[model samples]
Target: MKETSEKKAIIKKLMKEGKTYKQISEETGIHPGTVGIYGGKLKKAEREKKCFNGDRHLCKTCKYRASGARSGCDYIIHTGNERGCNPEVCNKYERGNRNETKTSSKGK
Candidate 1:
C-alpha cells in the first residue's frame, strides 16, 4: 500500500490535471470510494488557498459550467457537462420546476 503522503501527492497531481475520481482510482490502484476522500481533501486545501486570494466565484462564472438541465450556480454544476447559470448574476437564469418539460406538448 502507498504511504499516506505518497497517496496524497498522487491524488493532488491527478486532481490538478483535472482527472476524475474514477480516473484517479484506476491510475493509482485505489478504490473509487477512497478516491472521493482523497479528491475532497485536495479540493478543500485548494479552496482554502484560493479563499485567501478572494471570493473568486469558482462556480458562478466558471467557463466549465455546462449549458443545459444541470445548470445551476453551485459546485456540482461543474461535475458534468450540464450547463449552469447563477440566478444572482445571470439575468438569463431561470428557476425551473423539476416536473416541467423543456418543450410544450400542446400539439401532442
Candidate 2:
C-alpha cells in the first residue's frame, strides 16, 4: 500500500491536472468524499499562498480595489452587494469553472 503522503501527492497532482474527484478515487482507491475533503484543504492552502495582501478581507493587493472610494472595491458596484469580493466574478472562479467543465466532459 502507498503511504499517506504519497497518496496525497498523487491526489494533488491529479487535481491540478483538472481531474475529478471520482477519477482520483478510482485511480487511488480512495473514497470520493475523502478525495474531495483533501482537495478542499489543498485548495484553501493554495488560496492563502496566492493572497498577496495576507488579509482576505482587505483588498489592498486586489486589482479591482477602488482608489479612495467609499465602497472600497469595484466588486460592490459590479455585484450590487457588500460582500467586498465576490468569487462568482473572480478570475480564479472562472478558471475553476473551466477546469470543472473539462473534467466533467472527460468523465462522461
Candidate maximizing lDDT: 2
Candidate 1, clashing residue pairs? 66-82, 66-83, 67-83, 68-83, 71-83, 71-84, 72-84
RMSD of each: 10.6, 16.4
Per residue, candidate 2 scores C-alpha lDDT tens digits across 1-108 of: 777788789899999999998999998898788888889888878876776433354444454455453544554443465654344234422212112222234645
Residue lDDT tens for model 1, 1-108: 988789888888888899999999998898888889988877776666655323334444444434567753433433433334433333333344422323355878
What are the models' TM-scores?
A: 0.46, 0.48
Clashing residue pairs in candidate 2, if any? none
Q: What local distance difference test score does each model get? A: 0.61, 0.63
Which 10 consecutive positions of candidate 2 have the poorest summed lDDT?
Answer: 92-101
- Positional deviation of residue 105's Cα in model 2 after best superposition, in angstroms: 56
Regions of model 1 farther than 4 Å from truth: 52-108
lDDT of 2 at 101: 29
Best by TM-score: 2
What TM-score does candidate 2 get on C-alpha atoms? 0.48
